[model samples]
Target: MKFQNIFVLFFAVSMFFSTQNIAAQSDEVVINEIMYKSLKAFDTNDWIELYNPSDADLNISGWLLKDDKDTRHFAFPANTIIKKRDFLVIIESKNKFTNVHPGIENYVGSFTFGFGTDDMVRIYNSNLQIVDSVNYKSKSPWYPETDSLGPSLELISHELDNSKAQSWRPSYVMHGTPGRPNSATHTEDEGIDDMLLNVFPNPAISSINIEFDTQVDGDLLIEVYDVLGNKVKTILENYMQSGYYNSYWDGLDESGNPTPTGIYFIKVKSPNGILNTKIVKSN
Candidate 1:
């Protein structure tokens, strides 16, 4: 009779510890950002960013990443450790991604498969138990801009329930913030202007008009970059007062030669902040 009582108590204690361990594994690390759709102009490979918000280092070696149907699965290599409050990005193709935007150092893997516009992403522990999952979409309810050449879906906060669409927002930065803190997590300073830079007559035939407003006195630099991130032309560069200004680009390169018709990015730098907008040059 004493032996039976001892066995019951031991089983209850084991079950309690097992439940706690599972909870820790399921919530410590999470899928924080996703870029399943690339911009139309500067299209690049898709990616997923994982974040560890806990205070302790996590060894995720042998963990698995899978899509909704389990058709695509990627396993973390051995010795894979994510430092506390750090991020890790999984690239679909390193060559493709680096070709568009170079000098990105923090990341891992080249998952061969791509995610659907509306799909599921699940992470499982080494024991093959589900940890965290996100079912993201590209339509309304989800940020519509994330569906195409605008921004990637980013979790607003690590503490929020990432599985819900309401907890996500379109990344303020073009492309996406990978291997770094999410852009939505940062607080916007009211003192700085939003840098409402506008480009008119998009798909311009020969020349493009640029208008911007500044809130403070500072040097402003405006340049045009090609889809491959090459500097094609400098539209304007000078010190300007806090006021509205207009500039123009004549669809020409630095050498004064006519540039080919294609998609280009107009990057504006001012006292408040830097802003980027897309322009299409048509023949």
Candidate 2:
């Protein structure tokens, strides 16, 4: 009986320590999204996103993000409160991305560090203790296109791991849903690739055609923006069924005036996802 009591006590102690270790492993604020490459050009803008999983706010003040080599380290400002279940986006270039995703400007912070195709990102607390880390990849099973002109790699769910390749997915949006909900954080298995878009006659003289194929149905907002990021026109803003669709732009602005010949972006957004591509209008 004494042996039994001792065994029970030992087991209880072991369980307590195990639970404490598990709790320490789980981060309240985790790395949720990584946009290491920008569409149209790889060197455009890069960013990382963090999400607070806890019900209460997590103060990431003085948190440092460093690479595996420890060569680069970017620190967060003091009193950086990532609201409960909210996201914090750190971009490499605020000026470059603000034009595209003006909506997320308020949540944006600037970082000058670079995250390699296959690299380690470690987050340390104010005490310089490791909070969380993820070593991402640029190979298959991880979506290689994200290293080039593809979507940003987003964590599917906070329940999943931030370090695993399967836990990450490509952002359907051009730059990414930085400072906002991630595209991969969906319960449905239907992914961002359910819809595909292709723009031809990129540098068209008069008119340009935007064609896309969809495997799912949802409401979408399609708009055209010039090089200056001005909303020249809105092509479509309504529900669309699963099928191939086309949007024709006749080189005209919203006021029915001729638009100047320049580079423009075509953005197609839906509750499920978003897609963006560039087109050039030449005289």
Candidate 3:
């Protein structure tokens, strides 16, 4: 009985130490590469690439990537996994790419300020723990953060480059746009003509302003509608100039009385097309 008791005690101690080693090993997190290319600063619509250099497959499900605001959380798919020595590219477009394996679909896409800017990209693991972060604040080669264009990430080197190897090759190339790049230089069929429509004071307390740009002279119609598709007011219905124009609308119905605090939609219809955005009103 004495020998049996000693054997059980040894086995228990061994199991405890083995579990501790496993736990310690699991905590070892490493990021291989974070690269991308951007045109201008403060452009968040650029393409970004992330590389996994280690031998272990990275389970990125439930992981979160955020910018400075942390308001926009880029969630990885529950089944998303970055294979060993592989890379993934994220584009800030709405088009869905379901065929590509490492191509993160539009669902996992995110926008960021471009290169040469002061911006931060942070990644959090499944436990809501910040695994890694990249800050471009003091970096001279990087772009400065501004309101107009966001930052961009570019991958410059590949696996063997770490060893100063001449034969090292970059695994992939990624690029992104700030606003829509001008398509006039390319064939008309290959490029898209973009129009700009913007609103100020998004979360407005009383009134909001709208603006747009167009080439042809036409009449502009601005309207406010509730989420239920009920038209509350028509702010404007008149001919405007070809260049940019601004108009304001107080948070009121047709009778000029204050509307209740709620969510509303502001739509601008011009000769170019229709642009709509949601606005919140607070008392």
TM-score pick, better of 1 and 3 = 1
> Which of candidates 1 and 2 reaches a greater TM-score?
1
Model 2 segments beyond 4 Å from truth?
Answer: 1-26, 41-44, 106-108, 187-283
Q: What is the C-alpha RMSD of each candidate to the true structure, in Å?
A: 7.1, 9.5, 17.4
Predicted structure with the largest lDDT when compared to the true one: 1
Q: Estimate each model's TM-score.
A: 0.60, 0.57, 0.36
Model 3 reaches what TM-score against the true structure?
A: 0.36
- Give candidate 3 regions above 4 Å deviation: 1-37, 40-44, 96-107, 110-116, 137-283
Candidate lDDT values, in order: 0.80, 0.75, 0.52
After superposition of all CA atoms, the RMSD between model 2 and the true structure is: 9.5
Instruction: Please report the candidate that would top TM-score against the real structure.
Output: 1
- The residue-by-residue lDDT of candidate 2 on 108-172, one tens digit each, is 46777777888887888878888878888888677665776556888888888777888887765
lDDT of 1 by residue, 1-283 (tens): 9999999999999998754422234357989999898887757678888998877667788888898877679998887777778888888888877765576766778887889899998999999989899998888688656777557789989889998888987776678778888876652332236556778898799999998788778888999987556799998889988888888998899999999987677878776666666677988
Q: Lowest summed lDDT over 10 consecutive residues: which window, candidate 1?
A: 186-195
lDDT value, residue 74 of candidate 2: 84
